[model samples]
Target: MAVSRETEPPAGAAELFGETWTQAQRYADLLSTWGVDRGMIGPREVPRLWDRHLLNCVVVTPRLPQGVTVADVGTGAGLPGLVWAIARPDIQMTLVEPLLRRVSFLEEVVADLGLENVVISRSRAEDQAGQFDVVTARAVAALDKLTTWCWPLVAPGGVLLAMKGRSAPEEVEAARPMLRRLGVSDVRIETYGDLAVPTTVVELTR
Candidate 1:
């Protein structure tokens, strides 16, 4: 599958992404190659790497607080994690993935992007120690399972930002009991980007 460059960044992306837009484009190219070679991403996904993957990930930038530490759980091929690092240089991003191949890919991408604020960890969320201001994941698991894996990594007063699909409301309702049990102080669903295909995020505050 050939990677397509026909897809440009969404309007106003240059102002939002600033100098990092070029780096994001390079990262998208890498994802088309390394992400597919290692089976982390499907060949069919190459065409949508810009809008569906990179831009979708970057849309979450406005929601993040400045200079916070973020632990991206199950960061396969560094989806939103690496993209976030590229878009926001102030935050410290840890791309956590258990598989060696994914870890290697993430490490190389980090180096290739020269992202000094990024770190790649080959470990599951539950096994990882230390908490972060923001714990994030994209397409990793369902809401209930995601809570189990990610909640522990959220520091006191921190938040878990799980990038969900159209099922964001349903998942929040389904996970209400678990959220209560886990002492989640608040829960809300936020939508970002185009209204037609906005990115839905389930925000769980601890």
Candidate 2:
């Protein structure tokens, strides 16, 4: 089918996605094609889409409480948001994006996948109303600024899972004062999966 820079799914894709493996493939195709064309994903990302993007996001799905509502703030191209929705049908997913172009792309992807559990919110994180069981963001911003924006949307007793890279611990330390002010003492860095570059997530419970 001549997918643009098509890459094979990683060894554990099927294991991670289970019965939704096909849907995940379709989503990958979209990300490789439409997602790149629309500037949602870079062309350089296509070849490693599975490992760096898809798998990186799905591995964190186990952290989500079953059937809980999750909001992915600034979900550009639906990284962890749409990816999580595709992998976990049991939970409700909201992909919150401010840009209309991205929102349009997300809407098309949701409709194309017939994903009934996903919702597209055309608003920025700060403007988004209501709280959710989990509020998440990936490559959105640094811990301090990100927490400032996402903490409000996390319902009391809920959590904010910030997908970070190697700087997670440093970011946590830098944001300590802000985190303490938010009444968030239960913060930890959790790594998921057995991959060489496992996904690192900063989990903060409010």
Candidate 3:
């Protein structure tokens, strides 16, 4: 439905809906309507997106630098990208999804949210200009291939964050050579939350 009744506060463990429960309900309705209209989510997937998808994305989002520009590669349905935009309104975002249909869905979501600083690019992540401070992808492809696909879109001194299920240490090691080849040298992992399958955030830096 609406946005989550949740947000990680500056100094607290976490807060239930930064604003209010009613506001959360409103956001839930907004997102559900948008998801339904754009076909970004199916009727059954709504609950999952609200919990495991959207909330999961925002839960780990505080890990990033505030107000930084970010791009979401292979943003199929704009989970973390759109969720990030909603959580941190000041952070500029580009959702780079090569599929025109998905880009169209992103466009609708941006318009519905009235997000002024967001854009949808119909191009592969690697082909885009290296302009964003952070590049992110959520369960898009295998970590090894995804590393090569998204690393080039990151600005130097910036980072690429891969949101994954289960541990990606082996994937990170497997992707090390690809990372080095793509100029993403330092690879590290940060795991967080009590997910049934833990969420691992793979950070790639130059």
C-alpha local distance difference test of each model: 0.86, 0.92, 0.72
lDDT of 2 by residue, 1-206 (tens): 43457768978789999999999999999988898889998888998999898999999998898999999999999989998998899999888999999999999999999999998999988999899999999999999999999999999989999999999999999999998988889999999987779999999998
Best by lDDT: 2
lDDT per residue for candidate 1 within 171-206, as digits (tens), equals: 988988888888886899999986348899999988
Looking at model 3, report the run of 10 residues with the lowest lDDT sum: 5-14
What is the overall TM-score of model 2 with all chains considered together?
0.97
TM-score of each candidate? Answer: 0.94, 0.97, 0.81
Model 3, span 1-206: residue lDDT tens = 55442322232213523533333344456556665666766656654545567567767767778789999898878767877776676788888888887787778667765777788889987688757899999978988898777766778889888998665877877777777677666778887655554467998885
Give the clashing residue pairs of candidate 2, or none: none
Which candidate gets the maximum TM-score versus the true structure?
Answer: 2
Q: What is the C-alpha RMSD of each candidate to the true structure, in Å?
A: 1.7, 2.0, 4.9
Candidate 2 ranges beyond 4 A from true positions: 1-4
Residue-level lDDT for 55 in candidate 1: 75
